[model samples]
Target: MKKKVLAAILAAAMAMACLAGCSSSSEEASSDAAETEEAAETEEAAEDAEAAGEETAETAPAADGELIRVGIINNDPNESGYRTANDADMKAMFTEENGYDASFAYSLKNDEQITAAQKFIQDEVDFLLLSAADTSGWDSVLQDAQNAGIGVILFDRTIDASEDLYLASIVSDMEQEGQTAVDWLESQGLEEYNIIHIQGVMGSAAQQGRTGALDAKVAESDNWNLVTQQTAEWNSEKAQQIVQSVIDAGTEFNVIYAENDDMAKGAVAALDKANISHGVGKDVIIMGFDCNKWALQELLDQNWNYDGQCNPFQASYIDEVIKKVVNGEEITEKTIILEEKGFDATTITAEDVEKYGI
Candidate 1:
């Protein structure tokens, strides 16, 4: 009886061990299958992510295989007709169709322009094109751009920053423009010159250059007198008010030197309203800068005595510079000066108005 019980217990123990082994094997197989499936899903996800990245890169803007990225900073487009034309020219040149991924920022304030530059730097732009509203306070931001391997080109106006900070400067000679206008005025040989000087935004290169020549001339000469000098901020209405105030005060002035055509138009409007004669060989000698078409027409008709030419179409020059930069070629000129001239009512022809007018 003892042998029988021992044999039964041994059989039952072996059977239980075999059952446990089978269950362990089944669990191991299930775990292995699950791990393989997880690995496959992870690899598919990685591949999809890589493909998306490539697609994004392919769709991005480039000049040829890769688009050159440019950030342009300019003044308010509506500030004046010249500015409008300038902005339009910039827009036309810096386009994706022309092989550039371009971004633009516009402001009349210096601080705001600096902020925009910082943003463009953070975005890692390849180049920065600037037409600064103010000449001062650009050093630090331009230095930051230089540190980041970004090239800078100055257009329209120059900042007070170091030349090393920029690759090239394509600008009008503002001081020369002013001097030319003043020279023309001097040639008029007015016996007693009393002037109403209307300036653009204060501290701007245009204003400083234009105002400096006239101011110096007036200070040196006994005949040339500034009846009133004020900033019209490139606004016609403000210019009109400035002139109206001078007229209301019975301040006798023979010359109106407006910094821009819009302001000149405003000053003329005030003169017209006051029943004052102006223009060629009139009571007041009207002088203005930035030869807008209408203003040049005014000159051609002898309705304005003088208009100074400030060339606004500088995009082509800028584009060529950028191409040379991209190709790692030497820029022969550090400062590219645009050729400009002034027009007189007496000599300005219809062709001059059509060809030179902005």
Candidate 2:
């Protein structure tokens, strides 16, 4: 009976060890199951968050089937012929039919533009399209735009802002345009380079770039002499008065490098009033920018010496960029430069005028 009791006690101890072992295994299994469930939940949360982000990006403009809001700030449409084309292009692209609700503000003052941009930011526009009146004084506004998650696009001109602040820029290289004009001027084999440089709005991107090249070129050359340098503020009347003032002063300027066609026309008016013949082989050499249909005709008719092309139809390109941004696609090109050509009165043809005249 004692031997039976000892065997029974040993069996009881064995049963207790088995139960402890099973209990430990069950606890480990329960912990493992809990860990697995936690990992699955975390993964599902991440997926849902990612999907929500994608949906927010995809449906950015508004609720289903609503048009996106855009703010367009540009130099006044009355600023120049180029501006007229620019304004028209924007008007055509940012239409209700094109799935946009766009508001516009036009000014030649940078501070005014900054104010408009701030108002647009306050209004919560999805996109801000800029043809800045000036290049500087845009960092703060652009930073605010980044903060608000509004996409900014530059057209016709560029500005001093971080690449992160803007979506893309569609512009003509103003410096290159100036260089092309200067190179053509050099090719003319003129005896003297007495230039009357009538500039556009001071401190503007257009004025700066165009002036930079010519200024550099003049510095390197000994023959080039600027008889009078003045800003016309891109006004025909102001430009006319400028030329008239120069004429009254009796400054012996032979070449008129007017910044725009209107100013060039104004200079021509002054020359016409003075009976100073201008054109091919004339006393005054006339040059202008913005291939306005009428201006190009002047080149074709051999009435104007030269006219440089400044492309203004950047609205379509900006529209495409906005679409890509809205669709969550990557834009590889940060700056898209438009191709332009210069026309000479000597070489310009009717076909050339028709094909390229803006």
Candidate 3:
């Protein structure tokens, strides 16, 4: 009986040890499986993160180093020949090859331009280059740019903002351009000036500056008569309509003072259709701004009386200013006015057209 009990106890002990060994093996297997799953999950997360980093690198404007990001806000390239040349000049200068990562925004309206400026500021561009459509409504946006630590450069046109708002202004002296044209008109010494003043986009810097001198002159001079004053908005067709309406009304006008070459061309088209002789010593004198090659050619051929030079090639000056700012150099000249002149039909030479034409 004692042998029987001892054997039974040994058998039970063996069974218990086997059960404990089985449990230990099962726990080890579970741990190994869990470790493998965790490692796979970690690897997948790393791969996803790496892919995201690559995408960001691809989409970013600047490279690893030395790329100057610029945001150019300008008028529509198709707004006029002058604008087209201006846009082309900016594009040519601010290129990847030229060490700039430039982005462009265009609008003829002031509100739209301000919106673009806000976007560029939000984008954190290194610089903001502007050719404002209108002179007003810029103080707030420019101040915002200043607050954001972005450099502001004015080109082609001026704004009503304070000088402190912009780092540099490389622009045309528009009022001077108007004064030059008016001075030339005064030099003509017409006995009785009956003028059809065809203007550009209303409230624009160009329109205001160009018109201000003429308006003052007309207001002061007793002999000067404004047959009609109208805005063409820089559209040739609108200018034609304005002239045609005057013609139909039989308004006696001896001068067509168009604010731009395209508008002047339109005015001349009306004169041609009416068989009204124009050009040197003709029935009317044609005056225009923006020395487009064709417009200057018109002056050279004695078809247009005068063409004012607006100097659309401001890229070199702007590039230099940008370089100075980047290098932490002081900008001595706050406002750099481009040198410009007016060409008379009687004196404009082919060489002059070749040299000064846009």
Candidate 4:
């Protein structure tokens, strides 16, 4: 009986140990399942965060194909070769095909130009392009633009503003252009001759440049006298009238310093009507600025003594600057000074005409 009781107690202890072992195994299995589920949840959360980050990045600020509002203030649409070409280039680049919104204004006076600039600023244009008719009277307008966060780009002509006022300039050096034509005239070996200076609008940059060299020459020399100096205001009829007046005044001038091709052409018309001998190989030597096709043809035909090249195609460069600024790219130079040369009437060929003629 006692042996039977001992075996029964041992069996009971074995049963309890088996129950404890099963409970511990079940708890371990539950703990392992919980750990796996927690790991999966952690991985899913990480993936969700990564996907959200990608979405934010995709929606972040980008410059690709962005709309840029550009404002252009230039001379009259019917101004001249340089301005005409510039207008065509802008039209080509800023149309629906090129994907830009552009507005343009034309003026021949500083106050009018400033008013146009003010309008652009009021409209909150992204950029402002200027071809100033006069150098002065732009400080206030430009300052207002800066205050409005508009970037200014000078083209064709420059202003007398501080360097920080404008972002860049794409222009021909007017002084250099004048000096080039005058220097070429000097090389023609003409010593003693009266000259008629048919000038542009007074105080304009072109007038300042084209008039400077001849004025200095007059101030220094006694042999070459300026028979008449008058402002044609870049008008052909006015130029003709000025030349006719000089002719009627009985002045014996053998050289004509017309500030532009149109004026020079007008002067030639006057000379022709009056039966005055003129041209490169004639009694009177003629010099003109702006290598327009017609004017350069005149040079090539030896009808003009010299033609100075003043490039007016500013759209390509202005486009480049706008793209760079939009893309956060660095510009190597803020103020780009385009180099130019004079085309001698005697040496210009057809190839020169094709390449350099406007």
Report every candidate's CA lDDT: 0.86, 0.83, 0.86, 0.79
Q: Which ten residues in a row have the lowest lDDT in candidate 1?
A: 54-63
How close is every model to the real structure, measured as TM-score? 0.74, 0.72, 0.74, 0.73
lDDT of 4 by residue, 257-280 (tens): 999988999999999998988776
Error of 1 at 88 (Å): 0.2
Instruction: Give candidate 2 regions above 4 Å deviation.
Output: 1-66, 109-112, 134-137, 241-253, 351-358
Scored by Cα lDDT, where does model 3 land? 0.86
Candidate 3 lDDT, 1-358, residue by residue in tens: 7975676566556545554654565455556657887754554454443344323323222333357889999999987788888998899878775668899999999999999999999999999999998888999899999999999999988788899999999988889999999999999999999999999989877899999999999999999999999999988899999999999999899999999999999999999999999999899999999999999999988888999989998887787788678769999998999878899999888888887787
Candidate 2: Cα lDDT at 155: 88
User: What local lDDT does model 4 show for residue 262?
Assistant: 89
The TM-score of predicted model 4 comes to 0.73
Among these predictions, the greatest lDDT belongs to 1
The digit string of per-residue lDDT tens for model 2 on 38-138 reads: 76465445444434433333333323346889999999998666788789888977777566899999999999999999999999999999989878899
Name model 4 segments beyond 4 Å from true: 1-63, 109-124, 133-137
Order the candidates by lDDT, highest first: 1, 3, 2, 4
Lowest lDDT block of 10, candidate 3 = 54-63
Give residue 129's lDDT in candidate 3 (0 to 100).
Answer: 97
Q: Give the TM-score comparing model 1 with the true structure, all chains together.
A: 0.74
> Candidate 3, which segments miss by more than 4 Å at Cα?
1-65, 109-115, 134-144, 160-162
Q: Which model is ahead, 2 or 3, in terms of TM-score?
A: 3
